[model samples]
Target: MRTTTRMLALFAVPALTVTGCGLFTDETTEKMTDVANSFADALNADDPAAAGAVTTDPPRAADTIGTLYEGLGKDAHFEVTGVDKDAGTFTLDATWKFGKDGHNEWKYTTTGKVDDTGDGWKVGWDAATVAPGLDAGPLTYSAVYPEASRVLASDGELMTQQVVTVVNVSPGADLAAVANLIGPISPGITAPSLQSDLTAVQGKPITAITLRETDIAPIETQLAALANVTLSPQTRLLTVEKELASPTLAGLAQLWQSDADAAAGWAVRAQTAQGTQRLAGRDPEPTTDIRTTLDLGWQRAAESALAPITQPATIVAIAPSTGNVVAMAQNSAADTQGPIALTGLYPPGSTFKTVTVSAALQAGTVTPDSIVACPGSANIEGRVIPNDNNFELGNVPLHTAFARSCNTTMGRLAVDLPPEALTDAAAQLGLGIDYVTPGLTTVTGSVPAADTPALRVEEGIGQGKVTASPFGMAMVAASLAHGSAPNPTLVAGQPGTPDRTPPALPATIADQVKTMMRETITDGTATQIRDIPGLLGKTGTAEFIDDTHAHGWFVGISGDLAFAVFVHDANSSGPAVEAAGRMLRAR
Candidate 1:
C-alpha cells in the first residue's frame, strides 16, 4: 500500500491500534536516520558519489522521480516544517520541491524505518508513497500499446510467444508487421485469405484476419479493408463468400485466384496442411491458441528500415534470448518470394568462420597468438578459396585471420576440431534442425556430415551444407554476443509449451568466440563498422546456391538486438560487398 503522510492519518487517528511490539529506541536507528538525511543533502548538492557512499541500494527502473531518494531519502526533499511526538509516534509537516519551475508542490505522508539509537530517532527502510500522478513522469518500458503482435499454433496450442500487435489495429503500423501477425488471426477475421480464394474478378487482394467467431474487433481494421474478409460459423468451415461475380468484374477472379495459389490458401473442400492422425482430410484442426513472440515495434522497425536498390533483401531479427522472431521481410514485389534467408540452405558465405573458429579454439588447436598467412587465396581439399582483397601475403596472428575473414586460413583450421564436435557446436546454437518455429516457411540448413572430417573444414568456414536462415545466422551472432545459444522469435504467445533448449557452449568458449568477433569488427572483413560502438559481426560472400547468384550476408549486434541479413541471388555484378557492408552498418 501507499504509506504516505496523508494516509498516515488513517493509520493513527484513533480508528486503529498499532500492532507491532512497543517502540524501542536504539543507537543504530539514530545513526542511520542521520546518515539517510545526509545522503539526501549530498544529492541536493549534486554530489552523486557522496550520496552513493551512504545510500548504495539501487533504484528500480520504474521509480521515475524517486531517484532523489537513494540509500535513505536523498531526493526526499519534503520540507520538514516541524516535528511532533505524541503517544510513541513522530510526525513531520513539510512541502517538497522538484523542477526548475517549482512545478512539484505537495505534502508527503511517510513512515520511517526508525530505530531508537541509544539516542532519539533513526531511519530504516522507511519511506512514504508520494501522491499518484503528482509524480508525473515519462513511461518506462511497457507492452500496452495498440501494436501488432504475432502468435503461432500447432494442434491448437500456441507454440511461440505472445507477440501482441499494438499498432496493427491502429493506423500506421508497418504493412509487413501486420502481414506477419496476420499469420494467426484469420479465423476471427472471416478467413479473408479464403474469401480471397474464390473464383471471382479482380482488384487488389482483399483479405481479413480476426479472433474466433464474432463481430470484427477494432484490431481487424486492415483485414476489414478486404470486402471478402469474414469469420466462419460453428462448423469452422472458414468459407470464402464472393458475390459470384458476373463477367463484368473482369479482374475479380484473378484476385481471388491469387490467394488460392498459396500453401496457406483457404480451401472450401480440403482439410490438409493442419493435418490429422486417424484420417487425411477428415481430421479437424482449430485455430485456437495460436501465437508468436514477435515484438511489434522491432518488426515494424525492421520492415520500414529496409530499402533495397533494385535487388531483393531479406531481414530476420530473432530474440536470441528465446529464439523469438522479431521481424522477417522481403523488399520486393514478391507475389512468389520465399523466406530464403532463414530457410534457404546457402553457404554461410564468410560468416561461417565464426563457428569454425569456435570449433578450432574449443579443440585447443589454435590460440589467440597463433599465426597464419593473410593470403588472398589458398587451395586445400581439392578446392580453392580466395580472400576479398585477393592478396595472399605474410604470416599473421589467428586474431588477424578472423578480423580479415580469411577463408583459406579458416578452412585449414576447421579440420582441427573433429567434425562431430563442430556439428554439435552448430546444433547447440540451434542450427541443423527443422525449425521448431511455426510457419511452413522454416528451412533447416543441411547439417554437416558426421562421417567426413575433411568436409568439416569447409563447413566450419560456413561453406558446404552450412546454410542458415538470416534468423539462424542472426542466432549465431547473438550466441557470440552472449557467449551461448540464443533463442529468438518474431511472434507472441506460446506457439506451444516451451522446451528447454540445450544450454550454450561453455562460457569461456563463448567468450573467446565473442572476442574473435570483436577482432573481426576491429580489423577484419567486418572492419567497415570498426569504429561504430558496440558492433560485432561477420561478413560473407559465397558462391554456393547456384552459379547465377552469389549470396551476400551480414550478421551482427548493435546495442541489445542481433540481426542476420541477406542479399539473395545478389547480382554479383554490382558492389555486393560494399552494399552489404553499408546495410549491415545501418543496423
Candidate 2:
C-alpha cells in the first residue's frame, strides 16, 4: 500500500511542476521586456544618467553611454530580441542614426543580463553592448580629412598653396591690458568689444579672426604672452594673393568639396587606445590639385591697379574667346560695400552705348558713317538728355558720336529703334542673364523693357532702368571681341549658364561696333590709353542724383582680354580709363 501511494505522489508532482513552469516563464518574459523598453527609452532620450541606472557600474556606464552619443551626435535606441529565463539573459539590437538627414545608421546585436538585487529584476548593461565590438576603454571620435590640394592657373602657375593661421581670443585676467598689447598688431582692436566678446561665455574661447602667417609673425611672441589671445597655425589651401582672389578661392574650395564627397575624402571614426573603427564611411584617396582658368599675371595686374585707390574701385578681366574669368580685383575700400564688382547694380552710363550701337546697326537704323546730330542737351518727351558736361558735336558721323560717348546722340538713336530694342540688344550682349554655378555669386544686370519714348531715350544712354556690374560691362566687350556671347567660366569644367540663348548679331554689325570702340582710343574720350596698341574701348561718366556725383566706367578689349574698370563717385571717366591703361599695360 505504501509503495503504490509513493508512485502516485511522484506522478502528481510531475504534473504540478509542468504547470508552474508556464507561470514562471510568463512573469520572467514580462519583466525582461519592461527592462529592455526602459533601457531603449533612456538611450533614445540621450539621458546617460537614466541609462546608467539599469547597469552594474553606473558611473562607468554613464561615461561610455554619453561618449557614444555625444561624440557621434546621434540618437540611439534598442529593440529586444529574446529573453532566456534559465540563463537570466536577454538579447537586443541597438540602432543609431546620425546627421541632419538621418540617412546614416548603425545597427548591431548585443546582450544584457537579468540580475536580482533585493527589490526586483535589473538589467546588466555593458558599453560593448551599446556599440557592437566596443572594448573596455575610452572612445574618441575624429574626422580625418585628406591633405588640402593646390589651385593652379590655366598657365600652370600656382594660385594657392597649403598654409594658414587661425587666431582666437578668450576671457582673461586683464581685458584692458590685453587690448593694449594687441592694439598695435591689429589696428582695429577695441577694448570694449574685445572685452564684451571675450566675456560672452563663462568659460568658452572665441575665434577673433584669421590672418596669414606673415601677417602675425611680427607680434606672435607678444600675442602668445597675452592671457586672452590664442594662436593656432594650420596648413590649408589658400590663394597666394589672399586679398585678390579670396572670394573666388572660397568658391573653388566649395566646388572641390562637392567632387571630393563622392571620392570619400573624409571620415568620421570612433577610436580607442586599443583600435579604431570607421563609424560612417571609408577614408579618402590621396588628394590631387585643381586647375582653374585664371591667369595669375592678369590677376596681379588687376590687383595692383586697384590697390592704391582711396575710393571704391573694381577691375574685371575675361578671356573673350573662352569666356573664362582671367582676373577680378576690388580695392579694400570697395570690399566694405561687398563684392560690388560682380554683384553691384549701377547705371552703365555711356559704356552701354555698345549695346545701343549694336542694336542700331543690327536694325539698319544707323551706320558708322551715317550722320547723327550730337547737341549739348535735348528735351525728349519731357525728359532731358545731355552729353558729358553738355558737350556737343554737331552732325558728326555715327562712329564719331559713339567714340566721343555722346549721350544725346545715343538718346536720339534710341528713339529710332522699337521701344524694346535696347533691352533685347542688352540681352543679346548677356546682360539680364543669371549665371548659375557652384561658388559663383553674380548679379546679372537688369535692362527693363521700355514702354515709353522718354524711357527708351534714357535706356540708350545706360541710365534709368538700365543697370549693370563690372562683370556685365566686361561681357558686353567680350561679346564683340569673341563674335558670340561667351559663357564665362572660372573653374575649368564648370561653365555658367545664361537665362536663354540669344540670336547672333550680324558679323558686319559686330565688326562696325568694334571699329567705333577703337576710335574711342584713337580720337575720342578714352585717348588716355591711345598709346596702348590694339586697344578698343569706351569711357562713361554716369550721372548719379543730379550729376554732382558720377561713377566713372571704362569697358574695353586688349589683345585676347576684355575688361571693365569702375570707380565709384569718380565724377569723370578719366580715372577709370587711366586704371584700364595701367592694368592693360601691366598685362
Candidate 3:
C-alpha cells in the first residue's frame, strides 16, 4: 500500500510542474514586451531620461542616450519594429536627419536586449541599442565639405585654393616683439594697434595677420620662435597672381562659398576609444569650376598701362562680338574711389558726338558728307559753344566736322532736333540702358532730355545733364563695332538683360559713324593714337569743377576689341590718348 501511494504523488508532481512552467513563460513574455514598448516610446519622444528609466543602469543609460540623441541632431527617431520575447530582445528601426534643411537622412535597424535580473524586466543598456556596432563613446555629427572650386579666366585660373599661415598673438605675449617682427611684412599691424585690439577682446587671442605661403616662408621660423605666437596653416581662396586684385574678387568668393556648401556632404560618426567610426552618410560631390569672361592677357595689359599713372585712372574693355567684359582694371588711386570704372558718372564730353552724329544721320538732318560750319565758338539760343581749345574747322563736310569733334557743329545740329533725340540715340548705343547682370553691378549712364536749345547744345557735346561711366563709353564703341548694342556680361553664360530693348541702329548709320570714328583717329582729336591699325576712336577733355581741371577720356574700337580709357584730372585728353595707345600696342 505505501509503494502505490508514493507512485500517485510523483505523478501529481509532474502535472503541477508542467502547468507552472507554462504560466511563468507567459508572464515573462508579457513583461518583456511591456518593457520593450516603454523603451521605444521614450526614444521616439526623444526623452532620454524616460528611456533610461526602463533600462538596467538608469544613470549611465540616460547620459549616453542623451549625448547620442543630441549628436544625431534634433530630428532623430526610433521605433520598435519587432520584438523577440523568447530571446529577451527587440528590433528597433532608427533614423537620423542632418543638414541645413534636414534633407539628408540616415536609417538603420538595431537590436536591443531586455532581461529579468531577479528584480524586474528592464532594457539592457548598451551602445549598440542606440546605433548598430557603435562602441561606448560619444557620437558626433560632422559636415564633410567638398574641395573648393576655382574662379577660371579665359586662359587660366584667376582665383585658386591656397594655404595661408595665420599669425596669432596670445594674451600676455610680448606685443612689441611680435609687432617688430611682423609689422614690415604685414601692413596696418602696429604695436599700439595690436594692444588696442587685444584689449578689446579680453582673454582672447588676436590674429595679427594672414599671409600666403610664399609671403610667410621667409619669416615663418622667426615668428614661431617668439612667445605666445602661433602659426596655423589654413586653406583659403586667393588670387593666383598677387598683382591681380579687384573688387569683383569679393563677389566671386561669395559665389564660390555657395557652390562649396551646395556640394557638401554629411556623416554621423562615433568618436570611439579606438578611432572614428562612420555610421552613415554620403561622400561629398566634386565641385565644379566657376567660369568668367575675364581675359588674363587683357587684364594684365590694362593693369600695366595704368600702373604708371599717379592720378586716379581706369580701363574697361569688352568684346564687340560677345559683349563679354574682357578686362576691368583700375590704379591704386582709382581703387580708393571705389569701382568708379563701372559706376562713377562723369560727363562724356565730346564723346557724345558719336550719339549726335548717329541721331543726325537717323533724322535726315545731315549726311556724313553734308557741309557744315564749325567756328571756334558759336552762340546758339544765348549759349556759347566751342571746340577743344576753341579750335575752328570752318565750313567742312559733316564727317570732317565730327572727326575733328566740332562741338559747335554738333550743338547746332542737336538744337534743331526733338527733345528726346539724344536720349533715344544714347539708348541705341547702350549708354543709358539699364541691365540686370549676374555676378556684376554696373550703371550705363544717363542722358536726360533737353527741352531748350541752351541745354540741347550742352547735351550734344556730352555735357550738361549727360553722364557716363568708363564702362558706358566702352559700350558705345562696342555698339559701333557690332552694328548694335551688345548686352554686357561678366560671367560666362550669364548675359545682362536690358530693362528695355531699344530698336537696332540702322546698318547704314552705323557704318557712317564708324567711318567718322576712323577719321577721328587718323586726322582728328585722337590722332595721337593713329599708329594703331584698324583703330577707330574719339578723345575728350571734360571740364569739371573748373576749366583748369579736366578728366581725359578716349573710347575706341579695334577689330573685335572695344575699350575706354579714363585719366582723372588730366587737364587734357593727351594722357588718355597716350594710355590708349599703350594698351592697344600691348595687345
Top candidate (lDDT): 3
lDDT per residue as tens, model 3, 1-587: 99999999999999999999999988987887789889988988889899999999999888888888777765877788777877788888978888877888888888889998777888998878878655556878888888888899988999999999999999888888888878887667888899999999996998999999888988899889988999999999999998896656766787888788889898877787788888778899999899999999989888888988999999999999999989989999999999898898999888888999899899998999999999999998898987777899789999899888888999999999899999999999999998887766889899999988889988998888999999999999999899999999888998999999899999999999999999999998888778889899988878888666889989999899999999999887788888888887897
TM-score for candidate 1: 0.49
On the 0 to 100 scale, the lDDT of residue 188 in model 1 is 34
> Could you tell me which 10 consecutive residues in candidate 1 have the lowest summed lDDT?
241-250
Q: To one decimal, what is the Cα RMSD in angstroms of model 3 from the true structure?
A: 6.0
Per TM-score, the best of the predicted structures is 2
Alpha carbon lDDT at 553, candidate 2: 96
Q: For every model shown, what is its TM-score relative to the native structure?
A: 0.49, 0.91, 0.78
Given candidate 2, what's the lDDT at residue 548? Answer: 78
**lDDT (CA) per prediction:** 0.50, 0.80, 0.88
Better of 1 and 2 by lDDT: 2
Which residue pairs clash within candidate 3? none
Best first by TM-score, ranked: 2, 3, 1
